[model samples]
Target: METILFFIIVGIISTIFGKSKRTQGQSPKKPIKVSGMEDIRTLFKELKNEVSLPAAPIKSEQKVEVLQKSNRTLEQEYNQVRKESESSRKALAASRLQREKMKEQTIEVSKDECEPSISMEPNAQTLVNGIIWAEILGEPRSKKPYFPKRG
Candidate 1:
């Protein structure tokens, strides 16, 4: 409301000055409005251009090339997978053959272990036979007693 009152006072002062100037034989020039400016049209044109600017375009060619590269890498990976699978098959076959050979020699290992091949030197009967005598005398120490040869 105060702004409107201030504009009203300024308008009345301008009217009074116009009348006084007219009485002195001088016609007052009209105050120019915004229509007189040359740059106003260009200002509107710049605003319209800014509003019409296009959005940035999304590119897909680089992404497509990356996908193709990944496909080639997957192909190489599958080749390596196949080679490792063949190696594992060969190792498994060799292990099965080795297991069969060990099974066949188990009988010989048991025979050798059951009867150890002792030497029959002259010291064997005296030294080892005295141990047999000591074991026969120590029979009562065990749950089941043992006796030496009667002969």
Candidate 2:
């Protein structure tokens, strides 16, 4: 039993020391070179070329001419709008003046029509006669009294 226990302990210590020596004696693994690196670099170069390429350039004179044409058109449009606004304003003022004239004419015509004419005759004479007739005859049996019609 004692010899068996001593052998077991010696075996465990020998395994631990053997593993340390094996690890220390071995060399570290070198990094593997990838074959696809050249393809990636070429693709990056193509992207850089496409990005760095310049667009077709415009001449300074052509740019100036384009700007001048646009400015002229804008000025013409502004003038057209200004003329239209001025004409509309004139039409509005004319219409307002005509409306005021019509209003004044209507006021004058109404004054002439509404004025009471001076006359020596009394307008209530017929009413007084109607009252006298009603008192003499009292109320008639009909809805309307039998009074003589006058034009």
Candidate 3:
């Protein structure tokens, strides 16, 4: 509450002072000008005039020669990298093809190795005996005897 009252009093005082200053036709406070591109450009021009730097040591011919040498070296490096990339790509393709061939061979080997669990069908009696054994092992003996129906 005290803070609120203080803020209100300050606001009122500031407004009163502002009105008085305005009515006087001339304000004591001057309008501030924001710095713009033109101001920055003028400042830059003035700074350039005040501070002078020594000229570069290299002549135009030397600069051109250096630039040409650097360009040639850069082009050579680019071609070398391109050749290396192409060779690596070819190696990758070869490895992929080898991997694919190995996979195919593995699949063929697995097919050749696998054999069916039961090659021949069991006789009817053998099947019945198997069913009876399965029932005996799988379930508990009940009050009524269990028997498999004929197919």
* Winner of 1 and 2 under TM-score: 2
Model 1, runs deviating above 4 Å: 1-69, 115-127, 130-138, 141-151
Residue 21 in candidate 3, Cα distance off native in Å: 28
Q: Kindly provide the TM-score of model 3 when superposed on the true structure, using C-alpha atoms.
A: 0.44
- Error of model 2, residue 148, in angstroms: 30
Candidate 2 clashing pairs, residues 3+ apart or interchain: none
lDDT of 2: 0.87
Choose 1 or 3, whichever is better by TM-score: 3
TM-score of each: 0.34, 0.45, 0.44
lDDT digits (tens) for residues 48-98 of candidate 3:
966775455668999899999999999999999999999999999999999
**What C-alpha lDDT do the candidate models reach, one value each?**
0.83, 0.87, 0.86
The lDDT of model 1 is 0.83
